[model samples]
Target: MGFLLNNRVGHLLIAIMLFVAVVAVLLLIAKVADGLRGKARMPAVIAVFAGPALLMLAVGLIYPFIRTVWMSFMDARSQNFIGFDNYVTALTADASVIAFRNTFLWVILTPLLSTTIGLVYAVLIDQSRLEKAAKALLFLPMAISFVGAGIIWRFVYDYKGAGQDQIGVINALLNSVGLAPVRFLQDAPGNTIFLILVLVWIEAGFAMVILSAAIKAVPVDIIEAARLDGANSWELFRNITVPSIRPSLVVVLTTISIATLKIFDITRTMTGAQFDTQVLANQMYDQSFVFGNNGLGSAMAVFIFLLVVPLVVFNVRQMAKNREVRG
Candidate 1:
């Protein structure tokens, strides 16, 4: 099995066989279902189709979640029940405190700044002749992976000592003006802000695309009616445009908030979670894989899960409310 997995041709053959076997099993189930009558056939088919999916879900998501929660209460080696000690360490330890604070900053600032910038951009470019081209320029960053964006921005914020030739864009500009070069990623607290800026630059494009569609979907008839009633641009935007796109705004905020909560790549890529810039996900990775402290890692994972649940629930409820209003 190891040799087959190691060989590319053998691996491809195994994958092809697995795919063929799954198709064959489904076809066999269909053929068997055809032999049964209506009432029996429907349920038999449903069971056949849903059983594998439910089993996979249980093995993949449900089992790991339960295991992680259980491990959160165990000793580092999983040989003893520590019972809340790991949670205490995760929540109150100095490093954990800093991670939590940085995560809090990320959750608060990234969504608000990204959404606001995107919405303003969307409104400005709405129905303009250069709208498509302008939006394409902004949204291009969305195509870049988080790690790629971090690498790109690292060059932008790169630092060298005074009187040295600077390669970083920001430092180079500072040098041209005789301003001293600053260490953007080495400074504490402020370094976290610079890391968050990378995520914002990437997510703003996503926010713009969603909010732009929402703005354009606002009824033209409603806008004309408001204009006829002597509503100025600001009044129309504040009263009509915003309300019309409230659901999209909620979605963009919550989606970005969730993404921000799980942010790992930017921190790991640029600073390796150094210089007081670690967030929950980065902390979790460090504890689990780097430090080999499973209990504390699981505790951090559980904490992040707790924070994300409310945002996900609110997003779902808001979407349902929007659907009902549309219905």
Candidate 2:
């Protein structure tokens, strides 16, 4: 059985068959319930449908969330209640403060820069010659994993001892130009920006794809009318294109924000969070596993959840508003 399931085709076939079976059963139940009247019918339908969904949500999300929150208030061993000490330490500790600052920088810079580049590139390639090829080339970076990209960029930024052979492309270029090699990764503040640029590079492709679709969805008639009314290029973009794609913009920004907030792989792969390059997600890992401080880890995790919740809520509200407007 294991050998049979190990094959991709066999696994897909079984999954499809199982899904069809479940759907068939659900349809059969719905058909039978259609003939029944009033309270019993409604209750039966709810039991058949909503019960499983609710149960899964409770098991998957609710329970784990509650457990994490509970642990955040407990001690390192989770043996005694420590109140707000973990939270205080997470906020005030020097390492955590640095982590928060870096995270703030990443959150602010990544989405804005990536989205801006994507939007501009999308507009440029929207109707350009060889548009598909151009967009594909731009999006090629997204195909690589963050760790893989980090490793690649790490080589690009690799530094060597003075008077040694420079193997890194950047340093090699500098040496060829009769300049000194720059510490691209080892430098603080600037190194963080360099790392953020990597995320921007990957995310720009995603942003371009989404924003390009949004751009295409803008009403051709509306754009024509705006142009006929003497609206310049900038005016058309500002008033018509942007407003038309406002919902998509919200979605792209929020999605990028979420990705930025959860940034871990690149930082870990590139810097190992050394040299003052730590963020919340990596800090959470170091605290929980590396340093054996589960309580602090849980607190950091909860803090991350807190930071994300408002953005998620805002996104949900924006989606609802868009739906309402469409309706």
Candidate 3:
């Protein structure tokens, strides 16, 4: 018998393996289900609870993290060890430096804008007659993928030369008002900020949903008590509402911060990190895949990972503390 071991056949073999594994899991689940009503079922329950998740975590997260760390120390071929040379280069190189600055800008701007806008919108819409509808409308953008939103906003910011009719909404408006068309994507700092606006637009809806829920969860009695004590609207919002939702606010802020750290889609789709808009994640992609500098890309990836870790850890601790307080 002849055997096929080519690419297509290899993929078929992998698919077959997956199908078998899934079938085995189904059989095991069936067996577990049959034993569910047993008196002493702790072991079966334990397996049901932890088995697949542990296996997936080991295969997916832990393995990839170990692989990435190993890659960081390896050359482009991923064979030769390069010690700290890549790290040092990333820290000092001009492109990497720009990427670092842009990443900091993204980290600062996107979260602040998204969270603040969301909180404000939530506050404004809360208790209003059309609150749900207003919230749904505002939060609709969050349903769009980052790339989709980027493409949408790309058209909005599109511009044409002086005699050509402007196709971009912003430029069209400017032209209607007898103003010059601005190159939204070519401008340095402004372009970066414009890209950030897309992230903010996408994330604001998420922030709004979370913050609105937090607002609703605030005790009515506390607000009534504050109102009776002559707490003005601003005072009630500041002293009562905000304080009550402090934990949620922190969660929103830090969650968005982490998302901002890994921002790549908007940059990649909008400008491809051109004109000084390159953030760390996009820079990593460019370094590795575009420039064929795997070492530099890996180092950038490591840096992004390092930058995100503290934020994630802090967010987790805050969440834990919040849970403790609630408990």
Best model number under lDDT: 1
TM-score of 1: 0.92
- Per-prediction TM-score, please? 0.92, 0.86, 0.89
- Tens digit of lDDT per residue, candidate 2, span 1-327? 777657977879898998798778778788878888987799769867986688779989999999989998998889999999999999999999999999999999999999899999988888888999999998999999999999999999889977888988999999999899988889898899999999999999999999999899887999999889999989988999888998988888998998899999999999999889999999999999999888999999998999999999988898888789779
Query: For each predicted model, how many residue pairs clash, with residues at least 3 apart or on different chains?
Result: 0, 0, 0
Give the CA lDDT, 0 to 100, for residue 196 in model 2: 95
Ranking by TM-score: 1, 3, 2
lDDT to native, each model: 0.93, 0.91, 0.89
Q: Which stretches of candidate 2 lie over 4 Å from their true place?
A: 1-37
Q: Lowest-lDDT window of 10 residues in candidate 2?
A: 1-10
Q: Candidate 3 on 14-125: residue-level lDDT in tens?
A: 9999979976985797587666776656666666667778878998988877888888888877789999888888889888888889889888988889989999999998
TM-score of model 3 (CA atoms): 0.89
- Best candidate, TM-score-wise? 1
User: Residue 238 of model 3: what lDDT?
Assistant: 97
